[model samples]
Target: MLETLELLKISTREQDRVEREFNMGGAQSADKGHGYHVLRVQENSPAHLAGIEPFFDYIVGINGIPLDTPESRVLQDQLLANMDKEVVLAIYSTKEQELREVPMIPNRSWTSNPGDGLIGLSIRFCTYEATNEHVWHILNVAPESPAELAGLIPYTDYIIGTPHVTLHSENDFYEFIEAYTGHPLRLYVYNSDFDACREVVITPNHAWGGEGALGCGVGYGYLHRIPKTNKYHNSQLTYQGDLKQQPQQFNDQSLPVEKSHPSMTNTDVVTVIPTTITTAPLIIETPAEPPETNRPQQSQQYPNYHQTIHFNNDKVPLDP
Candidate 1:
Protein backbone atom coordinates (compact mmCIF):
# COMPACT_ATOMS: atom_id res chain seq x y z
CA MET A 1 0.00 0.00 0.00
CA LEU A 2 1.24 3.50 -0.97
CA GLU A 3 1.10 6.10 1.82
CA THR A 4 0.20 9.66 0.82
CA LEU A 5 1.27 12.55 3.05
CA GLU A 6 0.34 16.22 2.75
CA LEU A 7 2.60 19.05 4.01
CA LEU A 8 0.92 21.05 6.75
CA LYS A 9 1.12 24.79 6.14
CA ILE A 10 1.49 26.85 9.27
CA SER A 11 1.81 30.59 9.91
CA THR A 12 5.26 31.83 10.90
CA ARG A 13 3.68 34.58 12.96
CA GLU A 14 4.78 34.76 16.66
CA GLN A 15 1.89 35.42 19.06
CA ASP A 16 1.74 37.99 21.85
CA ARG A 17 4.87 39.77 23.12
CA VAL A 18 5.67 37.93 26.35
CA GLU A 19 8.46 40.41 27.13
CA ARG A 20 10.33 37.26 28.02
CA GLU A 21 14.07 37.07 28.46
CA PHE A 22 16.22 37.09 25.33
CA ASN A 23 17.51 33.78 24.02
CA MET A 24 17.35 31.69 20.87
CA GLY A 25 18.25 28.50 22.67
CA GLY A 26 21.80 27.54 23.60
CA ALA A 27 24.03 26.22 20.86
CA GLN A 28 27.53 24.77 20.46
CA SER A 29 29.56 25.01 17.27
CA ALA A 30 29.71 22.00 15.00
CA ASP A 31 33.20 23.09 13.94
CA LYS A 32 34.60 22.32 17.38
CA GLY A 33 34.02 18.57 17.27
CA HIS A 34 30.34 18.96 18.14
CA GLY A 35 28.25 18.77 14.99
CA TYR A 36 26.33 21.84 13.80
CA HIS A 37 23.38 21.22 16.09
CA VAL A 38 21.66 22.65 19.10
CA LEU A 39 23.79 21.68 22.12
CA ARG A 40 21.63 22.82 25.04
CA VAL A 41 18.25 24.33 25.88
CA GLN A 42 17.20 26.32 28.92
CA GLU A 43 14.09 25.27 30.80
CA ASN A 44 10.92 27.05 29.64
CA SER A 45 13.01 28.97 27.14
CA PRO A 46 11.41 30.25 23.94
CA ALA A 47 13.33 27.65 22.02
CA HIS A 48 12.12 25.06 24.50
CA LEU A 49 8.46 26.19 24.42
CA ALA A 50 8.59 25.97 20.65
CA GLY A 51 9.87 22.37 20.93
CA ILE A 52 13.34 22.80 19.44
CA GLU A 53 15.21 19.69 20.46
CA PRO A 54 18.84 20.14 21.36
CA PHE A 55 21.63 17.94 19.93
CA PHE A 56 19.45 17.46 16.85
CA ASP A 57 18.19 20.75 15.38
CA TYR A 58 20.52 22.48 12.96
CA ILE A 59 19.98 26.22 12.55
CA VAL A 60 20.17 27.34 8.96
CA GLY A 61 18.87 30.90 9.42
CA ILE A 62 17.32 33.10 12.07
CA ASN A 63 14.88 35.78 10.87
CA GLY A 64 17.07 37.32 8.18
CA ILE A 65 20.35 35.88 9.43
CA PRO A 66 22.36 34.12 6.77
CA LEU A 67 24.18 31.12 8.22
CA ASP A 68 26.17 29.61 5.37
CA THR A 69 27.19 32.80 3.60
CA PRO A 70 30.48 34.68 3.91
CA GLU A 71 28.59 37.39 5.78
CA SER A 72 27.52 34.94 8.42
CA ARG A 73 29.42 36.77 11.13
CA VAL A 74 27.66 39.95 10.09
CA LEU A 75 24.33 38.20 10.28
CA GLN A 76 25.16 36.90 13.77
CA ASP A 77 25.96 40.45 14.82
CA GLN A 78 22.62 41.66 13.51
CA LEU A 79 20.84 38.90 15.39
CA LEU A 80 22.52 40.09 18.58
CA ALA A 81 21.31 43.60 17.86
CA ASN A 82 17.72 42.34 18.12
CA MET A 83 18.17 40.94 21.59
CA ASP A 84 15.14 40.86 23.92
CA LYS A 85 12.88 40.83 20.91
CA GLU A 86 10.96 38.26 18.92
CA VAL A 87 12.54 36.63 15.90
CA VAL A 88 11.88 33.88 13.39
CA LEU A 89 14.25 30.93 13.16
CA ALA A 90 14.61 28.56 10.21
CA ILE A 91 15.77 25.22 11.54
CA TYR A 92 16.49 21.99 9.73
CA SER A 93 16.32 18.51 11.15
CA THR A 94 18.91 16.16 9.71
CA LYS A 95 17.16 13.13 11.13
CA GLU A 96 13.80 14.00 9.53
CA GLN A 97 15.16 16.05 6.64
CA GLU A 98 12.39 18.58 7.21
CA LEU A 99 12.57 22.38 7.32
CA ARG A 100 10.42 24.38 9.72
CA GLU A 101 10.01 27.86 11.17
CA VAL A 102 10.35 28.43 14.89
CA PRO A 103 9.11 31.68 16.39
CA MET A 104 10.74 32.73 19.62
CA ILE A 105 11.86 35.71 21.69
CA PRO A 106 15.48 36.14 22.88
CA ASN A 107 15.95 37.42 26.40
CA ARG A 108 18.17 37.00 29.48
CA SER A 109 15.70 37.15 32.36
CA TRP A 110 16.56 33.62 33.47
CA THR A 111 20.13 34.23 34.67
CA SER A 112 20.36 36.30 37.87
CA ASN A 113 23.62 37.90 36.87
CA PRO A 114 22.84 41.08 34.94
CA GLY A 115 26.33 41.42 33.46
CA ASP A 116 25.81 38.04 31.81
CA GLY A 117 22.65 39.18 30.09
CA LEU A 118 21.40 39.45 26.46
CA ILE A 119 20.86 35.69 26.16
CA GLY A 120 21.30 32.70 28.41
CA LEU A 121 22.88 30.82 25.58
CA SER A 122 26.33 29.95 24.27
CA ILE A 123 27.36 30.02 20.60
CA ARG A 124 30.58 29.81 18.61
CA PHE A 125 31.75 30.67 15.13
CA CYS A 126 31.52 27.71 12.78
CA THR A 127 35.17 27.04 12.23
CA TYR A 128 36.99 23.72 11.97
CA GLU A 129 40.46 25.13 11.48
CA ALA A 130 42.50 24.37 14.58
CA THR A 131 44.21 27.66 15.47
CA ASN A 132 44.25 27.20 19.20
CA GLU A 133 47.40 25.69 20.71
CA HIS A 134 48.93 25.81 24.19
CA VAL A 135 45.46 25.55 25.61
CA TRP A 136 44.08 23.47 28.54
CA HIS A 137 40.64 21.89 28.37
CA ILE A 138 38.80 21.98 31.67
CA LEU A 139 37.51 18.54 32.57
CA ASN A 140 35.71 19.35 35.78
CA VAL A 141 35.20 22.31 38.08
CA ALA A 142 34.68 21.48 41.76
CA PRO A 143 31.52 22.57 43.54
CA GLU A 144 33.06 25.65 45.14
CA SER A 145 36.47 25.77 43.53
CA PRO A 146 38.21 29.06 42.77
CA ALA A 147 37.71 28.25 39.11
CA GLU A 148 33.95 28.11 39.59
CA LEU A 149 34.05 31.35 41.59
CA ALA A 150 35.90 33.14 38.79
CA GLY A 151 33.06 32.30 36.35
CA LEU A 152 35.29 29.95 34.40
CA ILE A 153 32.95 27.88 32.27
CA PRO A 154 33.74 24.20 32.05
CA TYR A 155 33.69 22.45 28.66
CA THR A 156 33.56 25.88 27.03
CA ASP A 157 36.70 27.71 28.15
CA TYR A 158 40.29 26.75 27.42
CA ILE A 159 43.01 27.80 29.85
CA ILE A 160 46.02 29.15 27.98
CA GLY A 161 48.64 30.92 30.12
CA THR A 162 49.58 31.96 33.65
CA PRO A 163 51.26 35.31 34.36
CA HIS A 164 54.83 34.70 33.18
CA VAL A 165 54.77 31.05 32.15
CA THR A 166 53.60 29.47 28.90
CA LEU A 167 51.87 26.17 29.68
CA HIS A 168 52.97 23.54 27.21
CA SER A 169 51.49 20.42 28.80
CA GLU A 170 49.26 19.35 31.65
CA ASN A 171 52.34 19.06 33.91
CA ASP A 172 53.20 22.71 33.28
CA PHE A 173 49.78 23.94 34.41
CA TYR A 174 49.77 21.67 37.47
CA GLU A 175 53.25 22.79 38.47
CA PHE A 176 52.35 26.44 37.95
CA ILE A 177 49.26 26.12 40.18
CA GLU A 178 51.23 24.49 43.00
CA ALA A 179 53.72 27.37 42.95
CA TYR A 180 50.92 29.95 43.03
CA THR A 181 48.68 28.32 45.57
CA GLY A 182 47.09 30.73 48.06
CA HIS A 183 48.25 33.57 45.82
CA PRO A 184 46.26 35.47 43.20
CA LEU A 185 47.33 34.42 39.72
CA ARG A 186 46.24 35.92 36.38
CA LEU A 187 45.17 33.36 33.81
CA TYR A 188 44.60 33.68 30.08
CA VAL A 189 41.61 31.81 28.75
CA TYR A 190 39.95 31.23 25.41
CA ASN A 191 36.20 30.90 25.10
CA SER A 192 35.51 28.64 22.18
CA ASP A 193 31.82 29.46 22.23
CA PHE A 194 32.37 33.21 21.84
CA ASP A 195 35.43 32.98 19.68
CA ALA A 196 37.08 35.40 22.07
CA CYS A 197 39.96 35.45 24.53
CA ARG A 198 39.97 37.04 27.97
CA GLU A 199 41.94 37.13 31.21
CA VAL A 200 40.62 35.85 34.52
CA VAL A 201 42.18 36.05 37.97
CA ILE A 202 41.86 33.15 40.41
CA THR A 203 43.45 32.23 43.71
CA PRO A 204 44.36 28.55 43.98
CA ASN A 205 43.77 27.03 47.40
CA HIS A 206 43.19 23.69 49.18
CA ALA A 207 40.61 25.09 51.65
CA TRP A 208 37.81 24.97 49.13
CA GLY A 209 36.87 21.45 50.21
CA GLY A 210 38.30 20.11 46.98
CA GLU A 211 41.15 17.78 46.13
CA GLY A 212 43.79 19.77 44.25
CA ALA A 213 45.11 23.27 44.90
CA LEU A 214 42.86 24.72 42.16
CA GLY A 215 40.03 22.29 42.81
CA CYS A 216 39.53 21.72 39.09
CA GLY A 217 40.32 18.85 36.75
CA VAL A 218 42.31 19.38 33.53
CA GLY A 219 43.87 16.98 31.07
CA TYR A 220 45.43 16.56 27.61
CA GLY A 221 44.30 13.89 25.16
CA TYR A 222 43.03 13.38 21.63
CA LEU A 223 39.61 14.99 22.11
CA HIS A 224 40.24 17.47 24.95
CA ARG A 225 43.87 18.40 24.50
CA ILE A 226 45.39 21.62 23.18
CA PRO A 227 44.68 22.49 19.55
CA LYS A 228 46.78 23.95 16.73
CA THR A 229 47.43 27.69 16.63
CA ASN A 230 46.02 29.69 13.72
CA LYS A 231 48.44 31.84 11.75
CA TYR A 232 46.20 33.15 8.98
CA HIS A 233 45.05 36.78 9.07
CA ASN A 234 45.63 38.17 5.59
CA SER A 235 43.48 37.97 2.45
CA GLN A 236 45.37 35.27 0.63
CA LEU A 237 45.24 32.43 3.16
CA THR A 238 48.64 30.92 2.47
CA TYR A 239 49.45 27.59 4.00
CA GLN A 240 51.89 27.92 6.84
CA GLY A 241 54.16 24.95 7.40
CA ASP A 242 53.51 24.51 11.12
CA LEU A 243 52.69 26.38 14.29
CA LYS A 244 55.52 27.56 16.54
CA GLN A 245 56.82 24.82 18.79
CA GLN A 246 55.39 24.95 22.31
CA PRO A 247 57.82 25.91 25.05
CA GLN A 248 59.12 22.81 26.83
CA GLN A 249 61.42 24.51 29.35
CA PHE A 250 59.92 25.93 32.51
CA ASN A 251 61.61 28.89 34.23
CA ASP A 252 60.27 30.31 37.50
CA GLN A 253 62.32 33.33 38.52
CA SER A 254 59.40 34.76 40.52
CA LEU A 255 58.72 31.74 42.74
CA PRO A 256 61.70 30.76 44.90
CA VAL A 257 60.48 27.29 45.87
CA GLU A 258 61.66 24.22 43.93
CA LYS A 259 59.99 20.79 43.61
CA SER A 260 60.75 17.69 41.55
CA HIS A 261 58.31 15.74 39.43
CA PRO A 262 57.27 12.29 40.67
CA SER A 263 57.38 9.07 38.67
CA MET A 264 54.40 6.73 38.13
CA THR A 265 54.32 3.42 40.02
CA ASN A 266 54.14 0.02 38.37
CA THR A 267 50.42 -0.74 38.11
CA ASP A 268 48.35 -2.24 35.35
CA VAL A 269 47.12 0.66 33.20
CA VAL A 270 43.40 0.68 32.54
CA THR A 271 41.70 2.98 30.06
CA VAL A 272 38.03 3.74 30.49
CA ILE A 273 35.54 6.15 28.96
CA PRO A 274 34.07 8.09 31.87
CA THR A 275 30.29 8.15 31.91
CA THR A 276 30.05 11.78 33.06
CA ILE A 277 32.06 13.00 30.03
CA THR A 278 33.56 11.47 26.90
CA THR A 279 37.16 11.87 28.09
CA ALA A 280 38.78 8.43 28.13
CA PRO A 281 41.90 8.72 30.34
CA LEU A 282 44.33 5.94 31.04
CA ILE A 283 44.48 5.12 34.73
CA ILE A 284 48.06 4.51 35.88
CA GLU A 285 49.20 3.86 39.43
CA THR A 286 50.86 7.02 40.74
CA PRO A 287 53.31 6.34 43.52
CA ALA A 288 54.47 8.98 45.97
CA GLU A 289 57.61 10.85 44.94
CA PRO A 290 60.76 9.21 46.30
CA PRO A 291 62.30 11.23 49.12
CA GLU A 292 64.38 14.08 47.68
CA THR A 293 68.03 13.08 47.85
CA ASN A 294 70.70 15.62 48.75
CA ARG A 295 72.60 14.23 45.75
CA PRO A 296 70.76 15.82 42.78
CA GLN A 297 70.03 13.61 39.81
CA GLN A 298 68.87 14.48 36.27
CA SER A 299 66.35 17.29 35.77
CA GLN A 300 62.79 16.21 36.48
CA GLN A 301 60.03 16.60 33.87
CA TYR A 302 58.74 19.52 35.89
CA PRO A 303 60.89 20.70 38.79
CA ASN A 304 58.94 21.17 42.06
CA TYR A 305 55.81 19.29 40.91
CA HIS A 306 53.62 17.83 43.64
CA GLN A 307 50.92 15.18 43.46
CA THR A 308 47.68 16.28 45.09
CA ILE A 309 45.42 13.75 43.39
CA HIS A 310 45.32 10.07 42.44
CA PHE A 311 43.41 7.85 40.06
CA ASN A 312 40.36 6.37 41.81
CA ASN A 313 36.84 5.17 41.04
CA ASP A 314 35.77 8.70 41.82
CA LYS A 315 36.70 11.64 39.57
CA VAL A 316 40.31 11.06 38.54
CA PRO A 317 42.27 14.33 38.21
CA LEU A 318 44.74 13.78 35.41
CA ASP A 319 48.10 15.49 36.27
CA PRO A 320 50.55 13.04 34.73
Candidate 2:
Protein backbone atom coordinates (compact mmCIF):
# COMPACT_ATOMS: atom_id res chain seq x y z
CA MET A 1 0.00 0.00 0.00
CA LEU A 2 2.86 2.38 0.77
CA GLU A 3 4.58 1.61 -2.59
CA THR A 4 1.33 2.18 -4.51
CA LEU A 5 0.85 5.54 -2.73
CA GLU A 6 4.40 6.61 -3.75
CA LEU A 7 3.74 5.67 -7.39
CA LEU A 8 0.55 7.74 -7.42
CA LYS A 9 2.43 10.73 -6.01
CA ILE A 10 5.12 10.42 -8.73
CA SER A 11 2.45 10.29 -11.46
CA THR A 12 0.74 13.38 -10.06
CA ARG A 13 4.02 15.30 -9.99
CA GLU A 14 4.75 14.33 -13.65
CA GLN A 15 1.27 15.50 -14.68
CA ASP A 16 1.77 18.82 -12.90
CA ARG A 17 5.12 19.32 -14.63
CA VAL A 18 3.49 18.72 -18.06
CA GLU A 19 0.66 21.13 -17.28
CA ARG A 20 3.11 23.89 -16.33
CA GLU A 21 5.33 23.31 -19.39
CA PHE A 22 2.43 23.53 -21.87
CA ASN A 23 0.29 26.02 -19.93
CA MET A 24 -2.44 23.36 -20.03
CA GLY A 25 -4.44 25.10 -17.29
CA GLY A 26 -4.19 28.47 -18.96
CA ALA A 27 -5.98 29.87 -22.11
CA GLN A 28 -4.69 27.06 -24.33
CA SER A 29 -8.21 26.12 -25.33
CA ALA A 30 -11.10 28.39 -26.30
CA ASP A 31 -13.23 26.88 -23.51
CA LYS A 32 -10.43 27.44 -20.96
CA GLY A 33 -10.80 31.28 -21.31
CA HIS A 34 -8.73 34.21 -22.56
CA GLY A 35 -5.03 35.16 -22.72
CA TYR A 36 -2.93 38.05 -24.00
CA HIS A 37 -2.80 37.48 -27.79
CA VAL A 38 0.32 39.10 -29.19
CA LEU A 39 -0.82 41.29 -32.09
CA ARG A 40 2.49 42.95 -32.97
CA VAL A 41 6.10 42.90 -31.74
CA GLN A 42 8.28 45.86 -32.55
CA GLU A 43 11.80 45.23 -33.90
CA ASN A 44 14.76 45.46 -31.48
CA SER A 45 12.31 45.60 -28.52
CA PRO A 46 12.56 43.44 -25.42
CA ALA A 47 9.74 41.11 -26.57
CA HIS A 48 11.11 40.91 -30.12
CA LEU A 49 14.66 40.31 -28.86
CA ALA A 50 13.34 37.58 -26.56
CA GLY A 51 11.80 35.77 -29.61
CA ILE A 52 8.20 36.78 -28.83
CA GLU A 53 6.21 36.18 -32.04
CA PRO A 54 3.13 38.07 -33.16
CA PHE A 55 -0.33 36.71 -34.00
CA PHE A 56 0.58 33.03 -33.48
CA ASP A 57 2.08 33.43 -30.02
CA TYR A 58 0.07 34.17 -26.88
CA ILE A 59 1.17 35.29 -23.45
CA VAL A 60 -0.62 32.72 -21.36
CA GLY A 61 1.18 33.12 -18.03
CA ILE A 62 3.63 35.36 -16.18
CA ASN A 63 5.88 34.26 -13.24
CA GLY A 64 4.04 30.91 -12.92
CA ILE A 65 0.63 32.66 -12.74
CA PRO A 66 -1.85 31.79 -15.48
CA LEU A 67 -3.29 34.82 -17.28
CA ASP A 68 -6.49 33.05 -18.32
CA THR A 69 -8.75 35.77 -16.96
CA PRO A 70 -10.96 37.82 -19.34
CA GLU A 71 -9.87 41.09 -17.66
CA SER A 72 -7.13 42.85 -19.68
CA ARG A 73 -6.15 45.05 -16.79
CA VAL A 74 -4.87 42.07 -14.84
CA LEU A 75 -2.11 41.46 -17.41
CA GLN A 76 -1.42 45.20 -17.88
CA ASP A 77 -1.03 45.73 -14.14
CA GLN A 78 1.29 42.74 -13.82
CA LEU A 79 3.55 43.95 -16.65
CA LEU A 80 3.67 47.50 -15.24
CA ALA A 81 4.54 46.22 -11.79
CA ASN A 82 7.37 44.00 -13.11
CA MET A 83 9.07 46.57 -15.37
CA ASP A 84 12.91 46.47 -15.47
CA LYS A 85 12.85 43.16 -13.60
CA GLU A 86 13.69 39.88 -15.32
CA VAL A 87 10.37 38.02 -15.69
CA VAL A 88 9.56 34.71 -17.34
CA LEU A 89 6.67 34.87 -19.81
CA ALA A 90 4.76 31.71 -20.67
CA ILE A 91 4.39 32.02 -24.46
CA TYR A 92 2.20 29.64 -26.46
CA SER A 93 3.12 29.43 -30.13
CA THR A 94 0.36 28.37 -32.49
CA LYS A 95 2.84 27.98 -35.35
CA GLU A 96 5.22 25.71 -33.45
CA GLN A 97 2.33 24.17 -31.49
CA GLU A 98 4.31 24.48 -28.27
CA LEU A 99 4.42 26.50 -25.07
CA ARG A 100 7.76 27.95 -23.94
CA GLU A 101 9.07 30.28 -21.23
CA VAL A 102 10.65 33.50 -22.51
CA PRO A 103 12.72 35.53 -20.03
CA MET A 104 13.02 39.27 -20.67
CA ILE A 105 13.50 42.57 -18.86
CA PRO A 106 10.92 45.20 -19.94
CA ASN A 107 12.34 48.77 -20.17
CA ARG A 108 11.11 52.06 -21.70
CA SER A 109 14.54 52.86 -23.19
CA TRP A 110 14.11 50.31 -26.02
CA THR A 111 12.13 52.83 -28.06
CA SER A 112 12.29 56.68 -28.22
CA ASN A 113 8.47 56.87 -28.69
CA PRO A 114 6.64 57.16 -25.36
CA GLY A 115 3.43 55.76 -26.93
CA ASP A 116 5.04 52.37 -27.38
CA GLY A 117 4.75 49.89 -24.52
CA LEU A 118 7.77 49.06 -22.33
CA ILE A 119 8.08 45.64 -23.98
CA GLY A 120 7.16 47.11 -27.42
CA LEU A 121 4.42 44.52 -27.88
CA SER A 122 0.79 45.23 -28.71
CA ILE A 123 -1.34 42.43 -27.30
CA ARG A 124 -5.07 41.93 -26.91
CA PHE A 125 -6.82 39.79 -24.30
CA CYS A 126 -8.80 37.22 -26.26
CA THR A 127 -9.76 33.58 -26.18
CA TYR A 128 -7.18 31.34 -27.86
CA GLU A 129 -8.49 28.37 -29.86
CA ALA A 130 -5.64 26.26 -31.20
CA THR A 131 -6.76 25.52 -34.77
CA ASN A 132 -5.45 25.70 -38.38
CA GLU A 133 -8.87 26.62 -39.84
CA HIS A 134 -7.93 30.27 -40.34
CA VAL A 135 -6.61 30.42 -43.92
CA TRP A 136 -6.80 32.26 -47.24
CA HIS A 137 -8.38 30.15 -49.99
CA ILE A 138 -6.94 30.48 -53.48
CA LEU A 139 -9.82 31.07 -55.91
CA ASN A 140 -8.03 31.85 -59.14
CA VAL A 141 -4.48 32.18 -60.52
CA ALA A 142 -3.85 34.25 -63.61
CA PRO A 143 -2.05 32.57 -66.50
CA GLU A 144 1.63 33.56 -66.93
CA SER A 145 1.34 35.50 -63.69
CA PRO A 146 3.63 35.23 -60.65
CA ALA A 147 1.11 32.98 -58.88
CA GLU A 148 0.93 30.66 -61.89
CA LEU A 149 4.72 30.54 -62.20
CA ALA A 150 4.87 29.73 -58.49
CA GLY A 151 2.40 26.82 -59.11
CA LEU A 152 -0.57 28.04 -57.06
CA ILE A 153 -3.64 25.88 -57.85
CA PRO A 154 -7.07 27.43 -57.59
CA TYR A 155 -9.97 25.70 -55.72
CA THR A 156 -7.54 23.22 -54.18
CA ASP A 157 -4.89 25.31 -52.43
CA TYR A 158 -5.11 27.41 -49.24
CA ILE A 159 -2.56 29.86 -47.83
CA ILE A 160 -2.38 28.80 -44.18
CA GLY A 161 0.37 31.20 -43.15
CA THR A 162 3.97 32.31 -43.55
CA PRO A 163 6.91 30.79 -41.74
CA HIS A 164 8.28 34.20 -40.70
CA VAL A 165 5.04 35.67 -39.31
CA THR A 166 1.54 34.55 -38.36
CA LEU A 167 -1.35 35.99 -40.37
CA HIS A 168 -4.29 37.13 -38.25
CA SER A 169 -6.38 39.12 -40.74
CA GLU A 170 -7.25 39.03 -44.46
CA ASN A 171 -5.09 42.06 -45.20
CA ASP A 172 -2.11 40.50 -43.44
CA PHE A 173 -1.24 38.25 -46.39
CA TYR A 174 -1.63 41.05 -48.96
CA GLU A 175 0.49 43.40 -46.90
CA PHE A 176 3.17 40.74 -46.51
CA ILE A 177 3.14 40.09 -50.25
CA GLU A 178 3.39 43.81 -51.06
CA ALA A 179 6.33 44.18 -48.67
CA TYR A 180 8.12 41.32 -50.43
CA THR A 181 7.49 42.68 -53.93
CA GLY A 182 10.27 41.46 -56.28
CA HIS A 183 11.50 39.33 -53.34
CA PRO A 184 10.62 35.70 -52.70
CA LEU A 185 8.21 34.96 -49.87
CA ARG A 186 7.64 31.48 -48.45
CA LEU A 187 4.07 30.40 -47.65
CA TYR A 188 2.52 27.43 -45.91
CA VAL A 189 -0.08 26.23 -48.43
CA TYR A 190 -2.60 23.55 -47.55
CA ASN A 191 -4.42 21.58 -50.23
CA SER A 192 -7.75 19.90 -49.52
CA ASP A 193 -7.55 17.86 -52.72
CA PHE A 194 -4.41 16.09 -51.51
CA ASP A 195 -5.25 16.56 -47.84
CA ALA A 196 -1.69 17.79 -47.25
CA CYS A 197 0.32 20.90 -46.51
CA ARG A 198 3.29 22.22 -48.51
CA GLU A 199 5.68 25.17 -48.51
CA VAL A 200 5.52 27.34 -51.64
CA VAL A 201 7.91 30.17 -52.50
CA ILE A 202 6.40 32.96 -54.60
CA THR A 203 7.73 36.35 -55.65
CA PRO A 204 5.26 39.21 -55.98
CA ASN A 205 5.86 41.46 -59.00
CA HIS A 206 3.76 43.96 -61.01
CA ALA A 207 5.61 43.34 -64.31
CA TRP A 208 3.99 39.93 -64.92
CA GLY A 209 1.40 41.40 -67.38
CA GLY A 210 -1.21 41.15 -64.63
CA GLU A 211 -3.31 43.53 -62.56
CA GLY A 212 -2.25 42.34 -59.12
CA ALA A 213 1.26 41.68 -57.80
CA LEU A 214 0.71 37.93 -57.61
CA GLY A 215 -2.36 37.95 -59.88
CA CYS A 216 -4.32 35.54 -57.72
CA GLY A 217 -7.83 35.86 -56.30
CA VAL A 218 -7.83 34.85 -52.63
CA GLY A 219 -10.86 34.37 -50.38
CA TYR A 220 -11.48 33.96 -46.64
CA GLY A 221 -14.22 33.01 -44.09
CA TYR A 222 -16.82 30.21 -43.87
CA LEU A 223 -17.71 29.78 -47.55
CA HIS A 224 -14.02 29.87 -48.45
CA ARG A 225 -12.90 27.58 -45.62
CA ILE A 226 -11.28 24.29 -46.59
CA PRO A 227 -14.03 21.80 -47.36
CA LYS A 228 -14.37 18.86 -45.00
CA THR A 229 -13.17 15.51 -46.40
CA ASN A 230 -16.67 14.06 -46.54
CA LYS A 231 -18.20 17.13 -48.26
CA TYR A 232 -15.46 17.34 -50.91
CA HIS A 233 -14.85 14.68 -53.57
CA ASN A 234 -12.20 14.82 -56.27
CA SER A 235 -13.60 14.24 -59.76
CA GLN A 236 -12.58 10.73 -60.80
CA LEU A 237 -13.06 9.12 -64.19
CA THR A 238 -13.90 5.42 -64.25
CA TYR A 239 -13.73 3.52 -67.54
CA GLN A 240 -16.36 0.75 -67.66
CA GLY A 241 -15.22 -1.78 -70.26
CA ASP A 242 -14.67 -5.49 -70.55
CA LEU A 243 -11.04 -6.39 -69.88
CA LYS A 244 -11.28 -9.42 -72.22
CA GLN A 245 -12.40 -7.22 -75.12
CA GLN A 246 -9.66 -6.55 -77.71
CA PRO A 247 -8.70 -3.07 -78.83
CA GLN A 248 -10.96 -1.62 -81.50
CA GLN A 249 -9.47 -1.99 -84.99
CA PHE A 250 -10.06 0.87 -87.41
CA ASN A 251 -9.25 0.90 -91.15
CA ASP A 252 -7.85 4.09 -92.72
CA GLN A 253 -11.04 4.75 -94.71
CA SER A 254 -13.51 3.42 -92.13
CA LEU A 255 -11.91 5.19 -89.11
CA PRO A 256 -14.48 6.91 -86.84
CA VAL A 257 -14.32 10.71 -87.03
CA GLU A 258 -13.81 12.50 -83.69
CA LYS A 259 -16.90 14.69 -83.11
CA SER A 260 -15.62 16.42 -79.99
CA HIS A 261 -13.30 15.88 -77.03
CA PRO A 262 -13.92 12.76 -74.92
CA SER A 263 -14.94 14.98 -71.99
CA MET A 264 -18.02 16.33 -73.85
CA THR A 265 -19.08 12.79 -74.93
CA ASN A 266 -22.32 11.56 -73.30
CA THR A 267 -21.02 7.98 -73.12
CA ASP A 268 -18.33 9.03 -70.66
CA VAL A 269 -20.37 10.77 -67.96
CA VAL A 270 -18.49 11.83 -64.82
CA THR A 271 -20.76 11.88 -61.78
CA VAL A 272 -19.28 13.59 -58.72
CA ILE A 273 -21.18 12.62 -55.59
CA PRO A 274 -20.72 14.25 -52.19
CA THR A 275 -19.78 11.80 -49.46
CA THR A 276 -21.39 13.93 -46.73
CA ILE A 277 -23.91 11.99 -44.63
CA THR A 278 -26.58 14.71 -44.85
CA THR A 279 -26.14 15.72 -48.51
CA ALA A 280 -27.62 14.01 -51.55
CA PRO A 281 -25.66 12.72 -54.54
CA LEU A 282 -24.77 15.53 -56.99
CA ILE A 283 -25.27 14.38 -60.59
CA ILE A 284 -23.35 16.28 -63.30
CA GLU A 285 -24.15 15.25 -66.88
CA THR A 286 -21.78 16.01 -69.72
CA PRO A 287 -22.97 17.70 -72.91
CA ALA A 288 -23.77 15.41 -75.86
CA GLU A 289 -22.20 17.78 -78.36
CA PRO A 290 -19.42 20.34 -78.06
CA PRO A 291 -19.91 24.05 -78.79
CA GLU A 292 -19.49 25.27 -82.41
CA THR A 293 -16.99 27.96 -81.41
CA ASN A 294 -13.93 27.18 -79.35
CA ARG A 295 -14.71 27.95 -75.72
CA PRO A 296 -12.48 28.03 -72.64
CA GLN A 297 -12.44 24.86 -70.56
CA GLN A 298 -14.31 24.66 -67.26
CA SER A 299 -12.73 26.24 -64.18
CA GLN A 300 -12.47 22.84 -62.45
CA GLN A 301 -10.53 21.36 -65.39
CA TYR A 302 -8.47 24.51 -66.03
CA PRO A 303 -7.45 27.66 -64.12
CA ASN A 304 -8.04 29.99 -67.10
CA TYR A 305 -11.25 31.48 -65.71
CA HIS A 306 -11.38 35.30 -65.57
CA GLN A 307 -11.00 36.81 -62.11
CA THR A 308 -11.43 40.41 -60.92
CA ILE A 309 -8.22 41.87 -59.45
CA HIS A 310 -8.59 42.68 -55.74
CA PHE A 311 -4.95 42.63 -54.58
CA ASN A 312 -4.60 46.32 -55.40
CA ASN A 313 -7.00 47.20 -52.58
CA ASP A 314 -5.63 47.96 -49.11
CA LYS A 315 -8.20 45.69 -47.48
CA VAL A 316 -10.14 42.71 -48.79
CA PRO A 317 -13.33 41.79 -46.99
CA LEU A 318 -13.89 38.27 -45.73
CA ASP A 319 -16.52 36.10 -47.43
CA PRO A 320 -19.74 35.60 -45.48
Which digits, one per residue and each the tens of the lDDT, describe model 2 over residues 25-44? 35442223345665445567
What TM-score would every model get versus the actual structure?
A: 0.33, 0.42
Clash pairs, model 2 backbone? none
Root-mean-square deviation of candidate 1? 22.0
Q: Pick the candidate with the highest lDDT.
A: 2
Stretches off by above 4 angstroms in model 1 are 1-133, 168-170, 225-320
Which runs in model 2 stand beyond 4 Å of their true positions?
1-33, 136-143, 146-320
Residue lDDT tens for model 1, 1-320: 00111111212221111001111222321122211234334444445555554323455455533244322243234345666676665554322223345555556664454422232222222322222222457767877888899878888776644433434344545655655567676665656565444557788777888676666666544466433222111111011211112112211111011111122111111111121212211222223331222312322232222222111111112222
What RMSD does each model have against the real structure? 22.0, 25.1
| lDDT of model 2, residue 148 | 90
